[model samples]
Target: MERETESRVYGWEPGEQAGRTVGREYAELVGGLLDGQLLDVTGWTAADRAGGVLLIADLGLYGPGGRADYAPDDDDAAGGLFRWRGDTA
Candidate 1:
């Protein structure tokens, strides 16, 4: 791409430049946390100084029935049951 066109997308405004390096590092760290070989799918894209990339990944598991179950909730927020056993955070 022409420098002019490239500049338009990756161009750093006055403040955005400061976060560029940090954001790239953070993305990498997140990608590293996942195990691609064990997982069903993994994807990545990146740019040089002007653009950023996102790592798309998934386990590719699903129920063919497409049925979901949920429990009723109480006002106290303690009575509700979680579907996922692990930490959502």
Candidate 2:
């Protein structure tokens, strides 16, 4: 008997329509804690991209520990993914 395996797709791959926006005009987070978060980078400068960080609310925490900071993973920034950095004060 032959067995079938499921295939999974990861990350974003631009299509023909994406050609209009060739640069980092927009960004979206994938994987880890901040998955699916979209950001507008149309006016973001080089410095902004280098130092860009995101603060996300951690539903798992309460009070002062309720938020965390995330920074774009340099390895995956070209693909627009942010990784959890640390908990915010």
Candidate 3:
């Protein structure tokens, strides 16, 4: 296996205290995502030692008009998510 010299993201630098089996796995996954061109991903922590949900304010490489001004679950039109607010909405 060759090291990908051209990897665009930062290398995985984990904290010194490896909490447990779950934490170590999470760290490895995050490292892979970052190396695979995940930009601006932050505040990622394992939830209850379970795999977490990924909320994207911007669709990014996933689709067109990729810049997200608000979170997908915000139910705001200005953010361009166009979530159904209510019957009046």
Best by lDDT: 2
Q: Candidate 3 residues 1-88, lDDT tens each?
A: 2222322322323442222222122221122112232222244333422332232323244444232221223333332122211111
List per-prediction Cα lDDT, in the order shown: 0.22, 0.50, 0.27
TM-score pick, better of 1 and 2: 2
Superposition TM-score, candidate 3 onto the true structure? 0.19
Over 4 Å off, model 2: 1-24, 56-66, 77-79
- Give the number of the best model, judged by TM-score: 2
lDDT by residue (tens digit), candidate 1, 13-64: 4343332231232111111222111111123222231132222223212223
What is every candidate's alpha-carbon RMSD to the true fold? 17.4, 10.3, 13.7
How many steric clashes between backbone atoms does each model show?
Answer: 0, 0, 0
Residue 78 accuracy (lDDT) in model 2: 76
Whole-model lDDT, model 3:
0.27
lDDT of 2 by residue, 1-89 (tens): 22222211112243313222334345555544445555556787777866866454555244344655555677874746556665555
**Pairs that clash in candidate 2:** none
For model 1, the stretches where C-alpha displacement exceeds 4 angstroms are 1-27, 31-50, 60-89
